[model samples]
Structures are given as structure tokens and as C-alpha cells.
Target: MVLGGSIAGLFAARVLADAYDEVQIVDRDTLIDVAGPRRSCPQGKHINGLLARGQQVMEEFYPGITNEIFADGVPTGDLCGNVRWYFNGVRIQQQEAGLTCVSASRPMLEKHIRRRTAALPNVVFVEQHDILGLATTPDKSKVTGARVQARGQKREKVIDADLVIDATGRGSRTPIWLQELGYGLVEEESKKVGLGYVTQHYRLKSDPYHGDLSINPVANATLPRGAIFTKTDGGRVELTAYGILGDHPPTDQQGFYDFVKTLAAPEIHEALMHAEPLDEPVAFRFPTTLRRHYEKLDRFPDGLLVVGDAVTCFNPVYAQGMTVSALSALTIRNHLHSGAAPQPMQYFQDLSKNVIDPPWEMTNTVDLSFPGVEGERPLQMRFAQKFLKLVQYAATKDKAIAAQYMRAAGLIDGPEKMQRPGFMLKVLLKGIFGPAKKTPAPPLVPIAGGHVETWSEYRNAA
Candidate 1:
């Protein structure tokens, strides 16, 4: 049984169908046959693209998934050569080779995944039933099934299952349900980003960028601004601009234009100025990056597992959610293939350790750039930041440097890959001889209720 029919749930269901005799996905919203937005998916209208790693995972889990999406008119392009990435108002120069990433609307991608999952004879999608509680054994030790309530239904029913997986996303009530089952309290850590998103779709009347995806600007420590414009599955484009903290963007027509105008790059504003708007700007607020450590629980309910956003939700700016979800699904497949039917805790611990580490480090380290987030950054983080800036500086002049940095950014290589002797020597030489790019002045007023003594100290404290 899978709770919540989001992308995570669909992908999980797809993987589970191979191992289990029957895999059922329960969703609160009405599941649709066509590619359209559901009530639960507020971000559906926004731009969504599959990273290279995510695409590889999808094709691995379900063969020919990318070809299917492309057949549906989704645009595919090289991540390094085709994409225009901007960091700190400086455009990343193009490289010769990069990963071929696919771009599509949220609805289009979900629709394809949904179709693929639904095709399996062992899989079923149950809709319009909100999950009420977990049905456990008499001793309340193990989760046997889920209690669900459908609107206008006379009575609730218990759907039995041998195993239960929660892909309910950031708003999951699984933690509360676990506590009700006499399981110990779940430990949670959150970093409040105070970020709100404003997204609008437009009909691409003219392709000034010529079908290429472009980012207006990357998030800077000093200026928290970024935007994405990409072609979706149906030849339409979705543009999203994010504002930090209470710096919310307006949903009205003029307000949307004004918000685009505020980005570090002027191109997005100019594009919106000329394009025809297909949808009104929709606003959604994400309060924090949340992770629940169910694997760390001393006593967890048996036959229950959590995946995707319910496990670790990163800030969406990094676009790691779907990729991480794909990784979790892959982990599930690996466990089943191994023929070791260990406890769900064992499965979750292994999955959390393997799949969650890379994206977490990459995201949290970058999150430290925000002025208000509270965290401790070790010396390695400072070294990494300085190294990245040097790489970026070099990438501007050399295609090979740009390719290396893009590969790392796209999760093709681990952070330690840069620690090789040859790369380390280059970084050291660049640090010594490269023209020192002026670092932005730190915020004059302290944000965390204290004054930072110096930039080095501030980076360490963050």
C-alpha cells in the first residue's frame, strides 16, 4: 500500500509492482485519466525538468521512459551546452559536452509516470480517499493496513496490506500516525527558508531563445533571486520566480511583471513583457526544508516505510525532489532484488544512508548562503565555496572547466571527485594566481541577532 499519489507515490508503486502481488496507491485527490493538475499539486503549473541523474534512474526503473516522454512532445537538451545558467548575475559559459536532460511540465511528466504505473496488472490507484489512520495489530505494534475515508461514503474501510509505504510528500501526517501507534516520537530537523514561489505559464508565441532553457539568475548570498523558463511537454513554457522570506510575489498580472522585473537578470522581465500569458501567476509558500529520521527510530511500526519528500524534503531551488524520489525507488528495487526481506527499518536505513547523503550535503551547504538560516559550516564548506568560485571563474574562460563544474553541479560526480591530486593542484594554483574576483560585502546589519566578525568567521558560523 502506498499513501499519497504524488510523483513519489507513483514511482514507488511502479517499483513495488514488480516485487509484490498487489500494489495499491491511495490518494486524497481524484486521479485523472488525462494530463491535468490535481488539487494536491500546487506546483503543477510551474516549470519542471528532469535532471540527468533523475532521467537515468527513471529509464533504469522503467525502460524507455524518456523516449515515451519525448514522444509526448517533451523537449530534450544537453544540460551544459543547451542550458543558460546564471550564478550571481554572471552567466556560466557554455561547454562542449554535458548531460542530456529532459524538460516538461509537471502534469506531463506525472501523467506519463501515472500511465506507466497504471499499466501494470498488479498495480492499482485508489482515489478520493483521504488516509485517516493506520490499522495496526491488537498490541498496536505493527501496521497491518490503512483506514481510509472517501467523500460521501457511508462508512470507512480498512485496506489490508503486507507492507505500507508513505510517499505523502512534505505535508505527510505519517509522523503523527506513527506516534498514535505507540511508536516513539519521530525526530525532525528543519531549516526555515522563508521562501515563497510565484509561477506563471505562457504560450510561446516566439522562441527568442530558440527552444533553449534559460535561467535568469542563480541565488546569491547577498541577493536571493532566481527564475527558470523552460519548454514543457505541450510546447508551452512555465516561468517561475522565487522570493525569500516574506518577500512574496503578487499573483496579479502587474505584480507578476513587477516581480520578474526584480530578478538579477533583465532577460526574464523582457521576455515576460513580450509573451502572452496563458495562466495567472500562482503563489505557494514553502516554510522550511524538512527531514524526518524514521530510520533512526528505536522502535518503528513494522511493514511501514517512508520515501521521497516524507523522508527528506530539500529546498526546491536545487530541483532534487524528483531525483531523490527516483533514487529511493531504485533503493527499493535493489532491496527486493537482493532477496533479503529484511525489516522495513533495515531497508529505510540503507536507503536513507545511500540516497539521501549527496543531495542533502549539496543543498544544505548551499542553504547556508541565506542570511537568516542558522547552522554551523565547517572549514571544508568555506574551502568548497572558494573552490567553486575559482572553478566558475575558470569556466568562464575554458570550456573544459565549465564542463567539469557542470558535471559536478548536475550530480554526475561526487564532491570528493574534486579532491584528486591533479584537480587539487589546479585549484591551488588558481587560488594563488587567478585574478581575485571581488567578494560581495557581507550584510552590514546582522541577521541572526549577532554581528559577524569577518567573512571567514561568518562562513564558518553559517
Candidate 2:
């Protein structure tokens, strides 16, 4: 049984269906053929894109799914060459890295994955049900199943299962449930980032990206504000402007435009000037990046495991959540290939050491670089931040360095790849001697004559 029918649970169910006779996905939301964001996923309305590695993993799981999404009008492109990436207001040199980037909204991507998982013969979705808690054995050493209650019903019932996986996301009740079962509390590590972002869709009078998929002005310590202006499945564009350390984007129309004006990418602000608003700006706040040290636990019940944001919730700006969840699913597949239930300790150990550690360290290092973000930055972290800045500077001059940097950022390669002697020497030489040329700002095009209206005005007219 998989608890929570989001992307993580859906992936788990898909993998479990191959090993188990029947895999049941339990969620409070109606899981079948629904479009748009779910009430459970607060960040669903924001901009989301699959990194190169994530696209590869998803394609591996569901063959031809990428083409399917593209057929539905979602754009695809080379990770580095086709997307505009800005670091500290300087554009990274574009190069063909042969990496795939799927620019799809969170809802559209999830909808496609959910549809594929639902079509599996052995997978069933138990929708509109609240997950009461875990049902354990007499000694509470083994999980027998899950207790769930249908929506609006007082009666609760237990669904028996040989194995139970928790993909309940960051709000997982696993810790409290484990404490009740006599097991000690799971260790947790959190870094307070105080991130807030506001998103709004736009129907542009003209294409700003030309043929590119998106424009990203990544946040940095010097200017802790950024935005992702990207093309989505529809004939509209999505802009998610963000700030760190309590600096939040506004939901009001003029306030949102001012926020965009503050972004390093002036093109985004220029594009929005002529765009017709499709919806009122919506905001989401993420207080901290959280991780449950499940691997550190000495004792865990058999037949119980956790995946996705239940284990780690990354800073969304990095766009690592969905990718990490997909990787977790792959780990579960490896563990289940033995035809026996996975050992909790061994699985978590592998997950932490292999899957979670890299991105966790990367994001943490970047988050701590911001002086406003409250976290202890030791000497190593300070040195890493300096080196990363050097690399970013070099990336602006050298396409090879830019491609390699994007490879690491996309999770296609480990951070260690950046530290190799050859790479470090190249970065140093380029930084010291490379010609510094200013990248020309994108041309500000005039808005063609049209009566563009805000969403509120459009609604009022109707």
C-alpha cells in the first residue's frame, strides 16, 4: 500500500505493481483524470521543470512519456543551450550539452504521470480517503497495513498489506506514528531559508524566448531575488518570481510587476509589460528545507518504508524534489528485485549515501551562502561558496565550463565532477585570463497594439 497519491506515491505504485500482485494508492484527493493542481500540493500552481537527469529517469520508467507530453504541447530543449540561465545577473554561455529539458507545469507533468500509473493493471487508487495511521503487528515491530477513513465518514477501517510505503510528503505522520509504536523519534535536520514566491500566468503579445524554453535568473547572495519565466503546455507563459530570507513577491498586479522589475533578467520584466494576465498572482511560502534522518534510526518496523519529500524536502528553486522522488523510486525497484521486502535500514542507508546526499549538500551550500538565511557556515562552506562563484564567472566566458556546470546543476553529474584537478585548473585559468565581454541585454520590444486586460478586469467584463 502506498500512502499519498502524488508523484512519489504514483511512482512507488508503478514500481510496486511489478513486484506485488496488487498495489493500492491512498490519498484524500480524487486521483483519476483530474486536471490542474490538487489542494494537497500548494506549490502545484507554480513554475516547474524537469532537469536533465529527471527527464532520463522518467523516460526509463515510462517509455515514450516525454514524447507524449510534448505531443500535448509541452516544450522540450537542450538543457544548457536552449534555456537562458543567469547567475549573479550574468548569462551563462550557451552550449549544446545533449541533455533533455522538459518544460512542463507541475499540474501537467503530474497529470501525465498519474494517468500512466492509473493505467497499470495491478495499481489501484483509493481516493478521497484520509490516512488515519499505520497498522502494526502485535509487537509493533512490523507494519501490517494502513488504517484509513473515507472522506466525511466517522468509521475507519484497516487495509491489509504485505508492505506499506509512505510518500505522504513533508507533512508525513511517520515520526509521530513511530513514536507511538515504541520506536524512538526519527532524527531531523532543517535549514531555515524563509523562501517565498508568487506565480502568475500570461498570454504574451510576442515570444520573448525566441525558440528557447525558459529564462532563469537564479538567486544569489549579492541579489537574493530571482525569477523563472518559462513557456508551459498552453499558449501561455508562467512567471514565478522569488526572494529569499523573508523577501517575498507580492500578489497584487503592480506589486508583482515591481518584483519582476527587481529580477536580474530585465527581459522577463520587459516581456510582462505587454502580456495579458491569465490569473491573479498566487503565492507560496516555504519556511525551511527539511530532511528526516531515517537512515540514522537504529530500529524500523518491517514492511514500512518512506520515499520522496517524506524523507527530504528540498528548496524548490533548485527543482530537485520531483527528480529526487523519481530516484527514490528507482532505489525501491532495486531493493524489490530480490523478491523479498526491502530492509528498512539498508534501503535508507543507500538512499542517504547515494540519492539524497549530493543534492542536499549542494542546496544547503547555496542556501547558507545568503547571509540572511540563518545557518552555520563553517570554513568549508565559505570556501565552497567562493569556488562556486569562480566557477559561475568562468561559465560566463567558457562554454565548456558552462556545460559542465549545468551538468552538475541538473543532477546529471555529482558535485565532485566540479572539483576534479582538470576542471578546477581550467576554471582558474579561465577566471584569471579569459576576456571579459559584457553580454548584451535582450532587446526591449514594444507591445503591439492590443487591449490587454488583467484577469480581474476580464472576469468583471464577463
Candidate 3:
């Protein structure tokens, strides 16, 4: 049984369909018959991408899934040739080989996955119901089922299952549920980002960028500000601008335009200002990047597990969430293939090594560079951050550096690849002779609630 019907939940159900006698997905939101909006996912209204890694995993899970979505009008792009990346305002030159991804709105992608999951013979979707508690064995050592309340009804139901997987996302009730079941409070690690986003959808003109989605530019810094404009499935484009460290966008239309004008790249602003507005600007705020240390818990009740955003939520600037979910589904598949009961603790330990380690390191490495980002910096973190700066500086001139960086960004390789002999030599030579100065201090210091204020706080404050 899967606890949520988002991508992670659906993906998990697909895999379990192959392994288990029966698989059921439970959710509080009514599963709408069409590919339109639902209440559970807010980000579904915005643009989202299937990274190279995610594309591969999705294909593996549901064969020809990518082609099917693209066939429905979603365009695929070569990650290096089609997409553009900006680091600190400088465009990283594109490269060739092994970098390819798919672009589509979150709704279309979920529609595709939902259709596939729904078609499986042994899979069942139980919607419009709330899971009240877990039904355990007499000794409370094993979760045999879940107790649920039917939506808009006084009736209660019990769902019997051999295994239960939680993919309820960042605001999961699993921790509270577990504590009620005699477990201690779950260990958690979090880093405050104070990022705010305003996204608007537009209809592109039949011009240079109308049907082609070859370039998507992003800028993420201490004062992380960037814009994303990409082609969606139905001849539409999504233009979104976001700022980290307290630079929230105002709701007024003119203020929105001015906000985009401040981006490192003009692609997003240009598209938004020039294109036809399809909808009003929708705004959302994300407080912190959080990770629950489920693997460290000494005891996890048998027959229960967790995955997806509920496990480790990263800063969205990296666009790592869906890829991480796909990878986590793959991890769950491998564990079942090994003939083991779905072990929650063991699965998370493996996840930290597989799905979580690379992205966590990647995001946290960048976050630590921010002046007042509140998090403990390990000794190796300083070296890694400086070394990455060297590579970023070199990437401005060398396509090889850009390719390697993209490989890491795509989760195709670990950041430690930068420490390898050949790459390390180039970074060293560049650091020694290149005109780039030491990376600057973070532009602001953290104030209350781990929010940041301008650097002048040091000199002007009482």
C-alpha cells in the first residue's frame, strides 16, 4: 500500500504492482478524471522537468512513458544542447554527449504516470479518504493495516496490507503517527532557505521560441534569483521568477515585471513581458530544506516505510525533487528484488547513500556558502565549496568544465568527480593563474528565523 498518490506514490505503486499480489494507493484528494488541477499538489500548476536521470527511471518503470508524453505534445530537449544554465550571471557554455531531458508541466507528467499506474491489473487507487492510524499486531510490533475514515461519511474502513509505504511529501503526518505508536520523536535536519516564488503561465507567439524548448536559464546564489521559461505540452510556456534569502516578489503586475528585470538572465523576463499572459501570477513560499533522519532511528516498525519529499526535501533551485523520487522508486524496486521485507530503516540508509547523498551534498554545499545560512558545516564542506568555485570559474571558458558540472547537476555523477585527478589539475591550474578572485562573502547575514538581511546590517545596526 502507498500512502500518497503523487508521483512518488504512483511510481511506488507501479513497482509494487509487479512484486505484490495487490497494490492500493490511498489519498485524501478525489482523483479527478481529467488531467487538470487537484488539491494536493500546488506545484502542479507550474513548469517542471524530467531530468535525464528521471527520464531514464520513468522509462524503466513504465516503458515508453517518455515517448508517450512527448507524443502528446510535450517536447524533449538535449540537456546540453537544448538547455542553458547560468551560474552567478555568467552563461555556462553548452557541451555534447549524455545530457538529455524532457520538459512538461507537472500536470501532464503526472497525468501520464497516473494513466500508466491506473492501467496496471493489480493496482487500486483509494481516494477521498483519510488514514487515521496504523493497525498493528497485538504486540504493536508490526503494521498489518491502516484505519481510515471515508470522505464525507461517518463510515470507517480498515485496509489490510503486508507493507505500507509513505510518500506524503514534506508535510507528512507519519512522524506524529509513529510517535503515537510508541516511537520516539523522529530525528530531523533542516536548513532555512527563506525562498519565495511567483510563477505565471503564458502562451508563446509563433516565433523563435514558440514551439522549441531548447534553452532554460537559472540563477541560484546566496541572494538566489532566477527565472525559468520552458515549452509545455499544449503550446504554452511557463515563466517563473524566484528569489531566495527573503527577496519575495510583490503581487502587483508592474512589480512582477520589475522583479524579472533583476534576473541574471533576461530569458525569463523577456518571455514573460513579451508573451501573452495565460493566467495570473501564482505565488508560494518555501521556508526550509528539511531532511528526516529516518535511517538513524534505532527502530522502525516493520511493514512501514517512507520515500520522496518526506525523506529529504531539497532547495527547489536545483530541481532535484522528481529525479530523487524516481531514484528512490528504483531503490525500493532493488530492495524487493533482493528478497527482503520492505525495511524502512534499511531503505533510508540505502537512500542516503543512493538517492539523497549526491543531491544533499550538492544543495548543502551551495547553501553553506550563503553568509547566514544556519547549518553545521563539516570540515570537508569548505574545501568542496572553494573547489566548486574554481570549477565554476573555469566553466566560463571551458566546455569540458561545463559538461562535467552538468553531469554532476544531472545527478549523472557525484561532485567528487571534480576531485578526480584530471579535473582537479585543471581547477588547480585555473585557481593559480586565472583572473578570478576568491569567491565573495555571502551578501547578507541571517536574522531571526534564519532569514537574511543586506550586508549593511553589520555596519549600520546598533
Candidate 4:
């Protein structure tokens, strides 16, 4: 039994279906044939990126899924070569790295995955059900099933299962339930980011990307603001403007336009000047990145396991959540291949060491780079930040370095790949001798009835 029906829960159910006789997914929202975001998933209304590695993993699970998405009019491209990536206001040299990128909205992507999972013969979705808690054995050493109550009903019932997986996301009740069952508090680690973003949809009067899939102006210490302007399905464009360290984008129309005009990439602001607004801007706040140290627990009930954001929630700017959840599903698959229930500690240890550690450290390091964000910056972290800045500068002058950097960013490889002796020497040489040249911002054209003016000038005139 799975306690949620989001992406993580669906992935868990897909894998568990191969081992168990029947896999049931329980959630408060109606799960079948829904085409839009659920009430429970607020992040769905914003831009959601599926990194190159995530695309690979999803394709592996559901063969031809990429083509299927394309069939639905979603754009596809080479991860490094096709997208415009700017770091610290300088563009990374574009190169063909052969990594596949699928540009689909969160709702569209989840809808496809949910449809596939629902078709499995052994998988069933128990929609509109509230997960009450875990049903544990009298000794509190084993989990027997889950307690759930249907929506708009007072009666609660227990559903028996040989195994139970928690994919209930960051609001998981496992900790409190465990404490109630005689286990101590689950250790937790958190880093305050105070991140916020506002999103709106638009219809372009003219193409800004030419043939590219998306334009990303990544946030950095100096600028501290950024935006992702991407082409999605249904002939519409999605713009998600963001800021870090308590600097948030506004949801009002003029305020949101002002925020975009301030981004490092002026082309995005220029494009938006003539585009048709399809919807009002919406905002989402993420105050911190959280990790529950379930692996560190000395005692946990058997027949129970947690996956996805239930284990860790990274800063969303890195776009690691869905990819990490897919990787966790693969880990679950390996543990279940032995045809016996997985051991709790061993599974968690493997998950922590292999799946969660790399991205957790990467996001933390990047988040700490901003001076305003509060976190420990030991000597090692400081040194890493400096080196990464150098690498970003070098990536502007060298395509090889840029491709390698993209590999690491896509989660296909680890940061250690950039530590190769040849790679490090090249980066140093490029930093010392080959500084990036300044590229002038594109010229802005006047709209139908007005002369082009600076965003500040327009604001003052108003």
C-alpha cells in the first residue's frame, strides 16, 4: 500500500506491482483521468523541470514515454545544446552533449505517468481517501497495513498489506506516528533558503528562443534573482520568475513585469513586452530545504519504507525532486528483487549513501554561496564555491568544460568529474587568460503604439 498518489507514489506503485500481488495507492485527491494540478500539490501550477537524467530514468521505466510526450506536442531538445543557460549573467557556451530534454509542464508530465501506472493490472488507486496513520503490530516492531478514511465519511478502516511505502511528500506523518509507536524522534536536517517564485502563462507574439526550448537566467550571489522562460505544450509559454534569501517576485501584473525586467537576461523581458498574458501570476513560498534522517534511526517498524520528499526536500531551483524520486524507485526495485520484504536500516543506508547524498550536498553548497542565506560555510565549502565560480566562467569560453558541467548539473555524473587533473588545469588556464567577453543585450523594439523605454522609465511614467 502507498500513502500518496503523486509522482513518487506512482513510481513506487509501478515498481511494487512487479513484486506484490496488488499495489494500492491512497490519496485525498481523485487520481484517475485528471488533467490538471491537484489541490494538494501547489507546486504543480509553476514551472517544473525534468532534468536530462530524470528523462532517462523515466524512459527506462516506461519505454517510448519520451516520444509519447512529443506526440502530445511537447518540445524536445538536446539538454546542453538547445537551452540557453546563463550563470552570473554570462551565457555558458552551447555544445551538443547528447542528453535528451523533455520540456513539459508538471501537470502534463504527471498526467502521463499517472495514466501509465493506472493501466498496470496489479495497480489500483484508492482516491479521495485520507491516510489516518500506520497500522502497527502490538509489539510495535512491524507495520501490518494502513488506516484510511474515505472523504466525507466518519468511519475509518484498515487496509491490510504485506508491505507499506510512504510517498506522502514533505508533510509525511511518519515521524509522529513512529513516536507514538515507541520510537524516538526522527533526526532532521534543514537549511533555510527563504525562496519564493511567481509564475504566469503567456502567448508569444514572436519567438524569442528562435529554436531553443528554454531560457534560464540562473540566480547567483551578485544578482540573487533569476527566471525560467520555457515553451510548454498547447502552444503556450510559461514564465516562472524567482528570487532567493527572502527576495520574492510579486504576483501583481505590473509588479511581476518589473521583476522580469530586472533579471540578468534582458531578452526575456523584451519578449514579454509584446506577449499576450494568459493568466494572472501566482506565488509559492519554500522557506527551507528539509531532510529527515530516517537512515540514522536505530529502530523502525518493518513492512514500512519512505520515498521521495518524505525522505528529503531539496531547494526547487535545482530541480532535483522528481529525478531523485525516480532514483529512489529504482533503489526500491533492487531491494525488492530478492522476492522478500526489504530490511529497513539496510535499505535506508543504501539510499542515503547512493541516492540522496550527492544532490543534497550540491544544493546545500549552491544555497550557501549566497551571503544572505544562513548556513555553515566551513573552509571546504568556501573553497568549493570559489572553484565552482571559476568553472562557470571557464564554461563560457570552452565547450568541453560546459558539456562536462552540464552533465553534473543534469545529475548524470557527480561533481568529481570536474576534478580531473586535465579538467582542473584547463579551468585554471581559462580563468587566468581567457576571460568571457561581454555580449550586449538584444535591442528592444517598440510596441504597436509606444516607443521603447527602460523598465524603470516606464514605471516612473506610470
Evaluate candidate 2 by giving its C-alpha RMSD to the native, one decimal. 4.4
lDDT of 4 by residue, 1-462 (tens): 999998989888988998999999999999799888889999999998888888988998888888888777786777789888899889888898978887788999999999989889999889999999988888989999999999999999999999999999999999999999999899999988989999998876655675566899999998889998987877678899999988999999999999999997889988898888988999999999999999999888999999999999999999999999999998999998789999988889999999999999988889999998887899999988888888889998999988999999999988889989999999998865544985865454444333212222222332
Local distance difference test, candidate 4 = 0.87
Better of 1 and 3 by lDDT: 3
TM-score for candidate 3, residues paired by index: 0.90
Write candidate 2's Cα lDDT for 1-462 as tens digits.
999998888888888989999999999998788898999988899987677888899988899999999877776678899889899788888898988888888999999999999889989889999999999889999999999999999999999999999999999999999999999889999988989999999887754665576899999887999988877777567899999899999899999999899887888988888788999999999999999999998899999999999999999999999899999999999999889999999999999999999999999888998988888899999989888888988998999999999999899999999999999999988876533565776674443443223322222332
TM-score for each predicted model, relative to the true structure: 0.89, 0.95, 0.90, 0.95
- Clash tally, candidates in order: 1, 0, 1, 0
Candidate lDDT (C-alpha), each:
0.75, 0.88, 0.76, 0.87
Worst 10-residue stretch by lDDT in candidate 2?
Answer: 450-459
Q: How far is candidate 3 from the true structure (C-alpha RMSD, Å)?
A: 9.9
Any runs in candidate 1 off by more than 4 Å, and if so which? Answer: 96-98, 338-342, 428-462
Which residue pairs of candidate 2 clash?
none
CA lDDT for candidate 3: 0.76
